[model samples]
Every structure is written in structure tokens, then in C-alpha cells.
Target: MTIMSSTSLSSGLDSVTNKSYLLHFLQLLSTCMAFFLVTRESTWSVDISNWSMFVWCFCFAVTLLTLIAELCGLQDKLHFSWDRFLITSACYCALFCLSAAIIYPIIHLQIFPDGSPRHHVIAATAFSCIASVAYAVEVVWTCARTGEPSCSLLGLLKRLEIFVACVIFAFLSNTYPSERQPALVWCVAVYCICFILGAVAMLRHRCDCDESLPYSCLGFGQSVLAVLLYTTALVLWPLYQFNGDFGGQPQRSNELSCIDELTSYLCVWDQRLVVAILTAVNLLIYVADLVILTVVSDRGSTQGLRIPSSY
Candidate 1:
């Protein structure tokens, strides 16, 4: 038993030298640097800095935990497919870091005094960007590899759907669109429901429990529902937010509250516009997801019909 344990440990160590493992290492390192740089500075006073810190810290902790699991061969013992989990983690971390990379500089750089503090924030942003790229590369690399169980084109689309929903939430948070109109409340609900469904679907697939569920049918139904929900948001968001008849600001206001020249942060009008655009984008993604799910489901049913005669 001791000898067997020694061999397992040795193999796990050797596995770290692979190219795939190297990407994980890079992610871990970059996130660590970003987190360290941000926390070392006194930027916690900024509200946005807290969000940025959460991104870096979350990514760093998850990546470190993933690496430890890999090195300890925990994947072999776990019920869920570790490879699939890794791909999912990579996709989310990439999007999270990318948001931080964009938002941190815009918010923090403008508020900070020009000196060492700004430089630290700059360095942190750079590392966040690096980590984002590294995780993205990891996903692309995994997808490109053949004979991988959970690496499907549909998987990438699912991730995009979730990420877009997240971005919409971020935009809505800044402007509080739901507070503006009752219609917008339903839009927020759509985002939340669809986001939760997408997350559950991904988790189910990763856990290898998809076989027990009507995955294709569920995906098709979810796609159709998401498309319909987002379509409502896409129309109502712009109508209520941009129409003069609805008491909405039709254009960018000269009001001081609407403009912040220093941070170049998005104004209320701009945020609403962004939410509208993202709603449209998510609608398109769901449309595409529906189409693909339809095709795949049809092919599956056809294949099922043909399998009985071969025996």
C-alpha cells in the first residue's frame, strides 16, 4: 500500500509537466499577482475596487484549489469529470478577469492620485488581463483537442450565454433599471432564471449525469424560453429607457450626474443603452442555441431509431 501511494504521488508530480498543466500554472500565477498587487494597495475605499478584488481573489483561490486537486490526483476519485470542471472554471475565470481588467482601470485609475497607488492598480490590471488571456487560451486549447469528453461547441455557447447574462446584471446594478419601470423587473427575472438554468445544465453535464436526464429536450426548451424572455427585454429596455413619451431620457443629458469626465464611467443613459444591447446579444445567442439544440435533438432521435435494427 505504501509503494502504491508512492507511485501515485510520483505520477501526479510528473503530470504537472504537461502543456495543459502549464496553462493552469500560468492562471494560478497571474491571478496570484493580480490579487497581491491589488490588496497591497489602499484601494479598498473605492466601491468598484471591491468588485475587482473579489474577481482576483476568487480566481486565485479557485485556480489554486484546482491545481492542488490535480497534483493530488483527486480527479480520479471524484464522481464528476474533472476535465469538464476545469474547462468550466477556465471559461468563468476568463470572463471574470476580463471584466476586472476593463472595469478596474476605468474606475480606480480615474479616482486615484497619480503616483505609486495608480501604478499598483495598473500592474494589477495588467496581471488580470494576463490571467484572462491565459484562461481563454486554456479553453480554446481544450476545445481544439480531440477525443475529449466534454469539449463540445455547444459547451462554449452555453458559457457565452451565462457570461452575457452576468454582464447584463453588472450593467443593471449600476443603473438599477428594475427600479425605473415594472417591465424592467420582468427583464431582470428573465436574466436570473435563464442564468440559473444555464448554470444547472453546465453542472449536470460536467457531473456526467446528463445521461439520466432529457438533456437535449431540456436544452431546447430552455433555449426557446430564453429567446422569448430576452426578446421582451430587448424591446422594453430601449422603449422605456429611450422614449420621450415614456418619461425616459431620449438622449444623453448634460446633467452633471449623467457625465463623469474623469473616470469616463458609463452614464445612466449609456448604462441603459448597454443593457439594451446586451439583451439583444443574449437573445441572439439563445436563438443560435435553440437552432443547434434542435438540429442535435433531431439527429439524436434519428440515430435512436436506427440503432434497433443493427442488432
Candidate 2:
């Protein structure tokens, strides 16, 4: 009986390990290919290619490290939950690859000279897309297979909020025209603050230290704060960027003057619009998170107060 039980357990472990290994291996392979293809082109004048290379290299390194750590059982020695960390990392990697896949082609392909090798860009974009899909699948599979309460919908939301903030940061990094404007600075602060809070929440949960914290209260409070801050940003950003009275462009300029290298990647006007939209999207997400938390907490409290009949 003991021999049979050990054999069954070993088979289960092997099945689980095999799936994870295959997924991470695929992610590493695709990211490596994408990175190599882009670097081989040796085109750095565009500037945006740097971001592409960074994304591919980052994903490849992280995936390789994760696979190694898991295979060697190093995760058991970590202070935090390895599964949670993996899920969060995979989610961000997926988004990063997806953005790279989209942006790399848009910025480089159109600008490629007729005699230049555009196929490299095309192949790199394809590999990035594959890496993105693989990472996304890994996240979903891990969450579903583990079925950990911490990897629930709330966890997904937290990771998503962080990802959106990252995208906003990337767009803002292209240029900081709002540097002198206090309102825009405050908007950026809002993004930073909310992102930090979400990251903290994830950290606390993954580290198993949140049990002592008033989790529900803290989550609700943070959600409210995020909603308010994002609402302010959602209104202020568009006003300051699109209003003609503020010396802002009311429409995307079609003038060739807007066709410079910087604008070719993403114009200031378009970046502002994209940031505003993302802010609104995050605001809605926070509001949904708030509502869901409230409902869930209420249910929990009600269940706790329920009287059990004599059994």
C-alpha cells in the first residue's frame, strides 16, 4: 500500500512539474528569440526599440529564474508565497510582451526604409506575441490549478491595476511636458501612490502577514482613495492637455511638423489622451473592486453571525 501510494504521488508531482516546465520553457524560448531578432537589427536611433529589448530581456530573465527556482525547490525557503509571486510576475510579463509586440511594429515597421530588413522586425513581433500568450496562459493555469484564495479575483485586480499604472508611466516617460504643472504632478502622484498601495497589498498577502492587518478596512479605504484620486486625474488630465485655452491641442495634429522621431512613436497629444483613458479605466476598476469588497465583506460578516442549529 505504501509503495502504491508513493508511486501515485510521484506521478502527480511529475505531471504538475512537467506542465509548469513546458510553459516556462516556451516563455523563455520566445523571449530569447524576440530579443535576439531585435538586437541583431542594431537599430537604436528610434529609441523605442530600447523598450522592446528591455521587455524581451526582462521576460526571458525572469522566466528562466522562476523555472530554476521552482525546479530546485528554492521557493520553499522563500518568506513569501512563491505561487503568488509567480502569478504576479507572469501577469506583468504578459502585459509587457503584449505592449512590446504592438509598439515595436508600429514604431519601427512604418519607419523602415525600403532596402532595410523589415523581416527582422516582423519576426521579433511574432515572437513577442507568442511570449505574451504563453505568459498569459501560465497565469490562468496557475491560478486555476492552485485555487488559492489569495489568487482570487481580488488578486487579479491588484495586478491589473499595477499593470495599467506601468503603462501610464511608460507613456509619461516619453516626455514630461507637465513638469511645471502642479495638477499634472498631482496626477502622477496619484498614479504612484495607488500603484504602491496595490503593490503593498499584494506583498502583504503573499508574505502571509496580512492576517494581522485589518485587511477589509484597509482594502476598502485604499479603494476609495484610489477612486477619488483617479477621478481627479481623469478630469484634470484631459482639460489640461486637450483644451485650446490651455495651449493644448484640441485635436491630433496632421501637420508634418508632428511627424518627428518622438511624435512618430507617440505624439504628446495622443499620449495625453491615452493616459486620460487609462486613468478612467483604472478609476472604474477601483470602483468595481470597492463594490466587490463591500459585498464580500458583508457576506462574510453575515455568515459569521449566523446561528447554527443543534446538530
Candidate 3:
């Protein structure tokens, strides 16, 4: 496996698929938990009638862009060619934004009342979707072509991809299929399913690679933390989903004598606060990720030159 030429330097980048997949899964899970918690606290109305559709649309568009990048493979070196990277990245970004425009209305984000400040919803939803798609594409593309062979562990990436798929499916199951109780149930199902899938995928890969554990990590550890945060969000979001299930039940609300057991559970545990805390923590983690990526880039200069670390 020894490298004989500079031509093989691109193998280290694991491409855009798995890394982007993990980041998006975590990002969405955070927002979902945040919205769930705020609504429970009676502090904010987390509107998603318009927001959810854009998320859905962006997911599809990114799926296509990542797949394409994965197939073509991009330049991966300590210093990438900015001109080519910018052009390709912009092309990929356009797809995500354009597709979301058509998809938002299909999922009932348009259900918001007329002339009641849909602009924020529109702008936020569109911006979030675009950034999400861009991040996934960029990271994945970077990984696939980089010289760091250790980052290409199939075991790691597969788990992340499965996690993202679970989130997408969980959201879809709520609308297209039958209505299920405890919106939290869907969130829980996604978390458990993704956790299981990732665990199995990692185990299946049987990676023998090793890296030192310290106060800092290279790229792979960052991906692991991202998945873990996503799992935490999934567990936390159930609190709010259950609230939605109970609140939406008009027939049960009318009949006080035969109160639903689930409603009793929601009343006892305020779902809003739980979701808000989870969302806040997840956002904090998201910020941490940006910091981690920046730090790694800063260290890139010392990479092949074998400069000693203060750590």
C-alpha cells in the first residue's frame, strides 16, 4: 500500500458522501429537537408547515449532487485548486436551492395563513437547506480525494449514510403513510434504527486502522462525534413529537372522562423544554464542528512535512 508517486495523493479524501451525510443528519435532528422543545414551553410557535417541505426538497437535491461528486472524484491535496472547487461547489449548490422551491408547497409548508409573515419562513428554510447541502457536498468531496488513506474506512461512512437515510424516512413516514401517535415515536424510531444501522455497518467493515486518542482528533473522530450528537437529538425529539400527538387529538380533548393514557404522559412531562434543551445542545455541537474543521485546516500545513505538534 506504499505510495510510489504524487499521482496517488488523492486517495485520502473519502469523497463527499459519508461526511456530508453525517453532518446533515445531525443538523436536522438539532432543529427538530429545538422546535419540539420551544413549542412545549409555550414560548414559541415552531412553524414548519413551510419549512419541512424545503428540508425534504434539499435532501433530494443533495442526494443527487453528492452521488455525482462521489462518482467523479475531486482533487484532494493540502492546498486544493480554489477556482475549480468554487465552480463545482456553486453548481452543486444551485441544484439544492432550485429543487426546494418546488418541493416546499407539496408537503404543506404552504398551509400557513395568507399574509402572516411567511417571509421569514421562506428565507430561513431556503437558506438552511442550501447551506446544509453545500456542507455535505464539500466535506464529502474533500474526503474522497484527500491523501489521508485512513479516512477512507468504509465502515465509518456507511454508518453515517444509513443515519441520514433514517432521518429522511422518519420525516416521510409522518406524512405519506398513516398517522402515528407520539410524534416522538417517529424520532425515536429514527434514532434507534440509525444507531443500529451505523453500529452494524461499522462492525461489518472490520477496520484495523489506528490513530492516537488525545485532546484533539483528526477527521474520523469528528465524524464519530457527529453521529453521536445526531443520536442524542433523536432520543430528545420524542418529547415534543408526543406532545403533537396529544395536542392534535380533538376528540380526546372533548371527552375528559375517558382521557387517553398518552395524553396523560405528555401532560406529566412537558415536551417543549426537552426539545429546546436538545436543540440548544445540538447547535452548540454544530458550532464545535465548524471549529474542529477550521482547526484541522490550520494544521494542514504541517501534514506531509511531519512538523512536530505542541500536543
lDDT of each: 0.74, 0.75, 0.40
Task: Write candidate 2's Cα lDDT for 101-148 as tens digits.
Answer: 987888777777654458888888999999999998987787676744
TM-score-sorted candidate list, best first: 2, 1, 3
Q: Give me the overall lDDT of model 3.
A: 0.40
lDDT tens readout by residue for model 1, 1-311:
99999999898667644876788789888888888887787765544356677788888888888878877978799987666677688888999999989977887877788898899989989999999999988766654542243444455577888988877777665567546578777778888999998889777676322232234566667778888888888887788778888767886865354666642455566677878888888898888767766766656532221112111
- RMSD after Cα superposition, model 2: 5.2
Residue 85's lDDT in candidate 2:
79
Ranking by lDDT: 2, 1, 3
Model 2 compared with the native: what TM-score? 0.87
For each of the candidates, give the backbone clash count.
0, 0, 21
State how far residue 92 of model 2 sits from its true place (Å).
2.1
Q: Stretches of candidate 2 above 4 Å error?
A: 113-116, 207-215, 254-257, 301-311
TM-score of 1: 0.81
lDDT of 1 at 81: 61
